[model samples]
Structures are given as structure tokens and as C-alpha cells.
Target chain A: MKPILECKGLGKSFGQKKAINNINLELERGKIIGLLGPNGSGKTTLLKLANNLLTPTAGEIRIAGFNPGPDTKQIVSYLPEKTYLNEWMRVKEIVEFFADFYRDFDPDKALTMLSQLGVDAKDRLKTLSKGTKEKVQLCLVMTREAKLYLLDEPIGGVDPAARDYILETIISNYHEDATVVISTHLIADIEQVLDYVIFLKDGQIALTSAVDKIREQEGKSVDSLFREVFKC
Target chain B: MGWDFETDRPIYIQIMEKIQLLILAGVYPVGAKLPSVRDLAQQAAVNPNTMQRALAQLEEEGLVITQRTSGRFVTENEEKIIQARRRLARDQVTQLLVKMRELGLGKEQILEIINEIAEEMKI
Candidate 1:
């Protein structure tokens, strides 16, 4: 089977500053991958490039044998770092909106997750706390049966309890054929859930290896390795 | 129900050890159906693939059996379970002996220490 996401010599620059450079990656389906890096390391940029939110200045990125476009968008579910929902809209409204917009969206699943999170669907987005909003966004994103999930800092805002639920939700929602790519600095919290990890350093691919391989060979956690690699 | 893992070891190996310990303790009794891989993964907060690998290792060791249509189950053979218990006990003893040797204790001294501790425990 073709890799779910593939990139070769992929580079993206914002005029003078290059966000990511000469990146080559081939991610398979049915795995959870962590994209680890410090601030300004281009983790978000890489995700955005794959999601077709940004055009690569050099090289090419393909999702399941096709370039990033409408077809790829249909298969890729993305949760950006910032909250993009309209504050005036109610939780159920947004859920309905997503259901209407994305063919793969499951409103029932979204509603169930929201209730499980103690979030009321009748409440407007503006009334909820930041953490709650993040939860809602995650619920929406995860309810989609996309082939690839690109989540940026999915657990950064929530408390430990919510973080566990989010992780469980992620694992339970995807099928054996879907791939989840999570970009975050909280490597320790999500390390166990990841099958593989790709370390991004200064706009370049630093390292990519199976999580178990890192523990077995390096005799250290992925979090420890990340700290050592990106230490100030 | 929490699964604790050491950072230095491979997660799948840790998971495999955990399941073996559970089986030995009768937590997952012989011939009992095991939970689905996804459920186990969620409970352990690890990847499903990792859990699958661990369960596969268990199957290879004859500690688990997977049916075609039905789910996985613990081995029904009591003899196999007994052998597994012995093997685990041997591994533990080997590790303990290695630690004793590292502490500069001779075989006689280690035996004496073990006898003293066993007497104290009345076993």
C-alpha cells in the first residue's frame, strides 16, 4: 500500500526565513506519530504544508499518491494550534456545521464526546473556557473518519484528566488503516501512545525512529531524548 | 488498572511482561477471553500496534490463543501455564543472583542470606 503521507525534498520559506528545508518523510498508515520540536522548529509549518494550508517553496508532498489538494483535504483532518471556531456559534451548531461540511463527520460521535467531556452542546463557544473549547475542537476533529489526522498541540491546553480522555478518544476513533500525526512539545505525556516519532530541529528533519527503538537502543524515553537534543 | 512502564526499556517488552505477570497471577485466568487490542491499548495508554505486538509475543509463547472469528483467549493448558510460571521464577532468581554477585557476595553467602530471609518469612 502507498504511504499515507509522503514528502521528498519538501521545503517551505516565508520570504527570507525558511520554516522547513529539504524534508523527506514517508509515513505509513495505522500508526500514531509524534512530531517533536521546540518553538520555531517548524513543526506547525510542516503540518500546515501537509494539510495544504501552505504551499511548499521547493519539492513536493503527496498524500496517498496524490498532491495536497481537495482530495487530500477530504482525507486529512487537521486541528490547528489556534481555535478557529466562531465564538457566537453554539457547540451543537458547530457540530452540525462540521457534519454538513465534511462527509466523514459523525455528529452523534461528536455529541457523545462533548457530553463525556462535560461540555454542554447548548452552550455557545464564547461561553466556554479555553480548555473546554480545545476539547470541543478535538471532539470535532476526532469525530471525522479521515485517513490522516494532523493534530497540533492537542493536549497542550487541557488538564491531565482531559488529556487522558483526548488520548483515548484519539486511539479509539481511528481504524487500523488511519494514521495520526501529532505535533507537540509535550513528548513525555504522549510518548507511549506514539508508534514512531520525527524530531524537527531548525527547519530540518533531525531524527525519525520507532518509539520502542529509541527506548531499547538509547535506553531513554523520547522525552529525555527530546530534552537532550533541543536543550538550550 | 494503570500500567506503569520504565522509561529505559522497550514499551512492547514491558507490556509483554505485564501481561505475563497478569496471567501468572490469575488476573487473566487460564482460558479467559482477553480484551480487544484497542481496549487494552486504551487502558494501558499505549499504541494499539504496540499492544498487538505484545499480544502476538504472548501467542508465540503459547500463553495466548487467537481464534479465527472469536477474540484472543489465555492458553487453556494448565501445564503450559505452569511451565511459564517456572520460567518467570527462574528469570527472577537469575536477576537476583546477578545482583547478589554484583554486591560481592559469594554463592554460599547468598544462599545463607536467602535461608535467613525465608526463615524470617516462615516459608
Candidate 2:
């Protein structure tokens, strides 16, 4: 089967600084993959390139065999690091907006998760706490029946309880055949749910392998290994 | 019940060990239906594919059986359960002996330590 996502000699740059370079990756289906790195490691750049928010200065990327465009966008559900919902809109209205915008969006699943997370649909976005707003955004993204989920820092700023809820929602929401790529600096929290991990460093691919393989061979968790590999 | 894992080893191995211990300890009684793979994965906070891999290993060992329409269940064979328990106990003893030997204790000293611990436990 064709890989869910592939990058060949992928490079991105801004002015004089290179953000990503020579990235060759092929992500398979049914895996929860972690795109891990510290700040300024191009994790977000790579994700944006994959999501078509930015064009690569060199090389190419493919999602489910299509280049990042209208075709791939339909199959890719993305959650940026920040909340994008308008503060004046009620949570229910945002759900309706998403349902209308994305053909794959499941309003029922979004509503169920929102209610379970104690998010009142009648409440405006500005009324919810910061973490609650993030939760609502995540709910909207996860409810889509997309083939690839690009979750950038899905659990970064939330409380531990909310983090767990987000991780569980991620695990249960996506189809088994679909791939979910989660980018975050927090490795220990999400390590168990990941099947594979990609470590980025200084605009290059540092390491990529199955999570169990790393554990068996290195005799350390990914977090420990990350510290060792990227110790500065 | 909570599942604690050592980070340096394969998760599927830990998951299999946990399920085996649960079976031998009667937490999942013989012939009892096991939870679905997804439910077990959620409970253990592990990936579903990893949980499935562990279940497949159990099936290979004949400690668990699956029905085409229904789900997995602990083996009904009492003798198999006893054998599994005995195998696990033997492995545990072997590991203990190896550790004791590494500490420079001969077989006689190991036996004495066991006796001392047993006596202390009886009180």
C-alpha cells in the first residue's frame, strides 16, 4: 500500500535561514507517529508544509499519493497550536461551521466530546477557559473522518487531566487505517500511544523508528533518548 | 487494575505478562470472556495494535482462545492454566537464583535466605 505521507529531499527555508533540509520520510498507515523536537527544530515547519500552509523552497511532499493542495486538504485534518475559533461565536455555532465547511466532519462526535468535557454548547468561545477553547478546537479537528490527522502540539498547554482526555480522544477518534502525526516537545506523556517516532534536530532528521524498537535496543524511553541525543 | 510498565522493554511483552498474571491470579478467570481489544487498550493506555499483538501472542501460547463471532476468552483447559502457572513460577525462581548467584551467594546460602524469609513471613 502507498504510504500515508511521504517526503523526498524535502527542504524549506525562510530568507537566509534553513528551517528543514533533506527530509526523506514515508509514514505508513495505522500508526500514531510522534514528530518530536525542541523549539526551533522545524517540527512546525514540516507540519505546515504537509498541510499546505507553506510551500517548500526545495523538494516535494505527498499525502496519500497527492501533493498538498485541495485534494490532500480534504483528507487531512489539522489542529494548529493555537485556537482559531472566533471569540464571539458560541461553541455550537463553531461546530455548525465546521460541519458545513468540511464534508467529513461529524457534528455528533464533536457535540458528544464537548458535552463530555463539560463544554456547554451555548457558551461563547471567549467565555471558555483557554484550555477549554483548545479542547473545543481539538474536538472539531478530531471529529473529522480524515485519513491523516496533523495535530501540532495537541496537548501542550493543557492540564494533565485534559491532556489525558485529549490523548484518549485522539486514540479513539481516528480510523485504524488512518495515520495520526502528533508534534510536541512533551514526549513522556504521549510515548505510549505512539507506534513510531521521528526526532528532528537542527533542520535534519535525527532519528526515526518504531517506538518499541527504540525501547528494546536503547534500553531507555524516548524522552530519555531525546535528552541524550539533543543534550546541549 | 493498573498496569505499570518498565520503559526500557517492549510494551507488548509487558502487556502479555500483565494479562498472563491476571489470568493465573484469577482476575480473569479461566473460560471467562476477555474484554475487547480496544477496551483493553484504552484501560491499559496502550495503542490498540500493540494490545492486539499481545493478544495474538497469548493465542499462540494456547492460554487464550478466540471465537469467530464472539471475542477472546481464557482457555478452559485447567491443566493448561496449571502448566502456565508452574512455568511462570519456575521462571521466577530461576531469575531469583541468578540474582542471588550474582550477589556471590551459593545454592546453600540461597536456600538459607529463602528459609529465613519464609520463617519471618510466617509470624
Candidate 3:
């Protein structure tokens, strides 16, 4: 089968700064992948190109064999680092908005998750605490039955409890045929859940390996490997 | 609940140990059916592929049996379970011995210490 996401010689630049350079990667189905890097290492840039938020300056990228346009967008569910929910709308209204916008969105699943997190459906987005808001956003994103889930720092800015819940939600919601790529610097928390990992370093592909292989061959966790690779 | 994995070792090895603990503890009783790979993955909050690899290791160890028509089942052999328990106890003693040697204690001294403690506890 064709890979769920493939990038061939993909490069992107912003003015004089290059965010991604000559990166080639192929992600297969049913694997949870970690895209790990430091702050300026182009992790988000690569994900943005994959989502078509930014066009590649060179080479090509494809999702399930299609360009990152409408067709690919249909199968790609993205949760950006920032909260994109409208503060004026209530939680149920936001759920309804997603239900109306995305063909694959499941309102019931979103509601169930929201209730589990103790989030009331009538509460305005702005009234909820920051962590709760993140959970709500994650709940919305995960309720969609998309082929590719691109989550940017899903555990960032949340408490450890929320981080555990978010990780559990991710593990439980993935379909057997879908692929999930999580971009985060918190390797220790996410390592056990990842099948494969990609390390981005200064706009380059530093390492691409399976988690178990890293453990067996390097005899160190991915977090330790990341620290060593990016250490000065 | 998510499985707690140690940082230094391969996760599959930890997973194998965890399953062995479960089997020895009678959580998955002898002859009991084990959960499907996907279900176990969800329960442990891990990737299905990772869970499948762990199950493969268990199957290789003969601690688990896979049926063609039905699903996987815990080994029905009581003797194998007892062997597994003894193997785990031996590993624990080996680790204890390594620590004792690090502390500059000889094997005979360690044995004498164990005897003293055993007498005190009357076991």
C-alpha cells in the first residue's frame, strides 16, 4: 500500500531562513509517529507544509498519494498549538460547528469526551480554564474519523493530568488504518506510545527510526537520544 | 491505565515482563482467553503495533497460545507457570547478588545474612 504521507526533497523557506530543507520521509499507516525537535528546528514548518498551510519552496509532498489540497484536507484532521475555538460560542455550538463543517465529525463522541472531562455543553469557550479549553479542542479534533491526525503540541500548556488524558484519548481514538503524527518536544511522555520517531535538527532530517529499534540498538530512550543529538 | 515503561530498556521487554507478572499473578488465569491485540492496546494506552510486538514475544515464550479459529489464551500448563515464577525469583536473586557485590559483600557472607534474616522471621 502507498504510504499515508510522503515527502520527497521537500523544502520550505521564509525570507532568508529555511525551515525545512531537502527532507524526504514516508509514514506508513497505523503508526503513531513523533516529530521531535527543538524550538527552531522546523518541526512545525514541516507539519504546516503537510497541511498546506505553507507551500513548499522546492520538491513535492503528498498525503495518501494526493497533494495537500481539498482532497487531502478531507482526510487530514489538524489541531494547531493555539486554540482556534471562538470564545463567543458555547461548547455545544462549537461541536455543532464542527459537525456541520467536517463530513466525518461525530458530535456524540465529542460530547461524550467533553462530559468526561467535566466540561458543560453550555459554557462559553472563554469561560473555561485554559487546560479545559485545550481538552475541548483536542476532543473536537479526535472525534473526527480522519485518515491522518496532525497534532501540534497536544500536551503543551496543560497539566500533567491533562497530558495523561490527552495521550489516552489519542491512543484510544486512532483507527487501525489511520496514521497520527504528533509534534512535540516532550519525548519522555510520548515515547512509549510511538511506533516510530523522526528527529528534526536545524531544518534537516537528523534521525528516523522505530522506537523499539532505538531502545535495542542505542540502549537509550528517545528522550536521551534527543538530548544527546541536540546537545551543544 | 497506561503501562509504565522504564526508560533504559526496550519497551517490548518491559511488556513481556508485565504479561508474565499478570500470568503469574493469576490476573489472566490459566486457560483464560487474553484480550485481542487492539483491545489490549487500548487498555494499556499504547500503539497497537507495539502491543502486537509484545504479544508476539509472549507467544514465542510459550506463555500464551494462539488458536486459529478462536483468539489467544493463557497457557493451560500449570508447570510452565510455576517455571516462570521460579525464573522470575531467580532473576530477583541475581539482581540482589549484583547489588550485594557492589556493596563489597561476598557470596558466603550474603548467604549467612540471608540465613540470619530467615531465622529471625522463622521462615
Candidate 4:
């Protein structure tokens, strides 16, 4: 299958400091990719490059054979690490806003997800707990029919139970033929669904391969390898 | 269904697989009781959620049977254990054979070594 996202010598810098350096990646369709890295290792920056949130300092990145821009954003559904939703918007209104902006957004899917989480659309976003808000954000992202989904820290916070739900929701809802790049530190949790992994360290690609092949060959889980290589 | 953390595999899978292995080994015995998920999870130092995933998977695969509130018990059908073992062994041998061929060991040489090793088997 053709790569859904391609990066060749991709480098990003902020001022004099490097964010991501000389990275090459090929994201295949219908694959769940885990982006593993220590804090400040540039996993988020690389995702941003794909989303066109930040322009690369050098080299190239292509999503679905197109450079990242408004056209690419249409195909890339992003869930930022921080809350991207406005606090004052009612749950129902926010869904409409997303539906209006993104042609691929499915209002019915969004409603189904919210219903599964027991979130009432009439409630204001500010009244919901932080965890609930996160789920709401997840519901929105999962509602899209994009060709690529860039999720940053989808399970960074919240309790362990919620983590399972978050992971399951992503897994069950994501459309096939689309690439899902989940940048997270929770390796053991999401590694089961991961077709590939990109381990970043000090702004560089440390390791990248099929998660199953690594497990089959090295007899090591992705988490253990992460601990050994990127251990503090 | 306790997990071994040392292996690269996830703890939840370890628990599921170990229980499956015990069933295959006849250690649990057919139709006998299995450890509670809570106890097994505690022994394995894993979260109950993880344990739940393992149990759910086992149940889905028909390797285990659960009763509501009465706790999970081993299934009477012993063929599942044998089937699991056969599948696992088949995979291992296929992998080993492929690797041996890559190392220039022909089938006869590999079988001779296997026979030699089998001669010293405790069983």
C-alpha cells in the first residue's frame, strides 16, 4: 500500500534549537502508529509538521501525496494534547461547528460517541469534568472520516479506566484505509493496536519498525524497549 | 492468571497466556477451578482493567468460561488446551525450521539434533 504520510529528511527548528532533526518516516494506510519519545523529544513537532501546524525548517512532508495545508487539513483530523474546544460552547453547538468546518465530519457519529460516554449535548463544556471534556474531544476526533488522524497525547491524563475507554474508542471508531498516528507515552496501552512505532529521542528518529516484528524478533514489548533506550 | 513483567509482552496477555498454558499443561486440570481475576491480577501486579481484557479475550476464544458473580471456572472440554498447545508448537517449530534453514541446517541434521535432545527428555 502507498504511504499515507511521507517524510524525507524532515527537520524543524525553533530559533537556534532543533525541535525535530533529519527524520524520515512513511506512514501506511490502515495502520495504527505509535510515536514514542521522552518529554521534549519532538514527537509532537513531527505530528505538527504533518498537520501543517508548523512548517519544517528543512526537507519535506507529504500527507496523502499532498503537502500539509488547508487541503491536507481536510484529510487530517487532529486532537491536540491540550483542550482544543472552547469552554463556553454547549456540547451540541461544538459538534455543529466542527460539522460545518470539516466536510468529513459526521454529526451522527459524534452524537453516537457522546451518547456512549453518557454526555448530554445540552450541557455546557465548562460544567463537565476535565476527564469528561477530554472524552468529548476524543468523540469529536473519532467522528471524522479523514484519511489520516493525528492524535497527540490522546491518553496522557485521566485515570486508568478512562485510558482503556479512550484507547478502545480510537480503535473501534477509526475508519479503515486511513492512517492513525497516535503520539503518546502510554506504550503498553496502545501498542497492541500499533502496526508500527517511531521512537524519537533528542529530536531524532531512534527506532521505527512493525511492532509485531519487533515483538517476534526481539521478544521485547515496545514499552520495554522504550524504557531501555529512552530511560532517564 | 498472574503476569510475568520481565518479558516484553504485556502483563494482561501474560496472564491470559499463562492460564491458557496451565490448562494445556493439565496443571489446572479439565473442568477445575481457575484463580479469581482479582487474585490473579494482584499476583501479577497488574490493574484489574488489564486482567479484564485478558479474561475477555480468553472467554472470546472459548479457552475460558465465566459465571456471573460465581467467579470463572475452567471449561470441561480439554481439547481447547491441546489445540492451543498444538498451535503454539506449530508456530514455534515453523519459526525454528525457517531459522535453521537460514543457518544452513538441512532437515535431516535438524531432526538428528532434535532426536538427540529428545533422548535426554525427562518424560
Highest DockQ scorer? 1
lDDT of each: 0.94, 0.91, 0.91, 0.80
What lDDT score is found at residue B68 in candidate 4? 84
TM-scores of the candidates are 0.95, 0.93, 0.95, 0.69
Candidate 2 structure quality by residue, lDDT tens digits, A95-169: 999998899999998999999988999999999888889889999999999999999998987888878888887
RMSD of 2: 2.1
After superposing candidate 2, which stretches have Cα over 4 Å from the reference? B98-123
Model 4 scores what on Cα lDDT?
Answer: 0.80
lDDT of 1 by residue, A70-116 (tens): 88889999999999999999999999999988999999999999999
DockQ of 3: 0.74
Judging by DockQ, tell me the better candidate of 3 and 4. 3
Q: How would the docking of model 1 be graded? A: medium
lDDT (tens digit, per residue) of candidate 4 on A109-148: 8988788778899999999998889888988988889889
**Candidate 3 regions with alpha-carbon error over 4 angstroms:** none
Candidate 1: residue B21 lDDT (0-100): 91
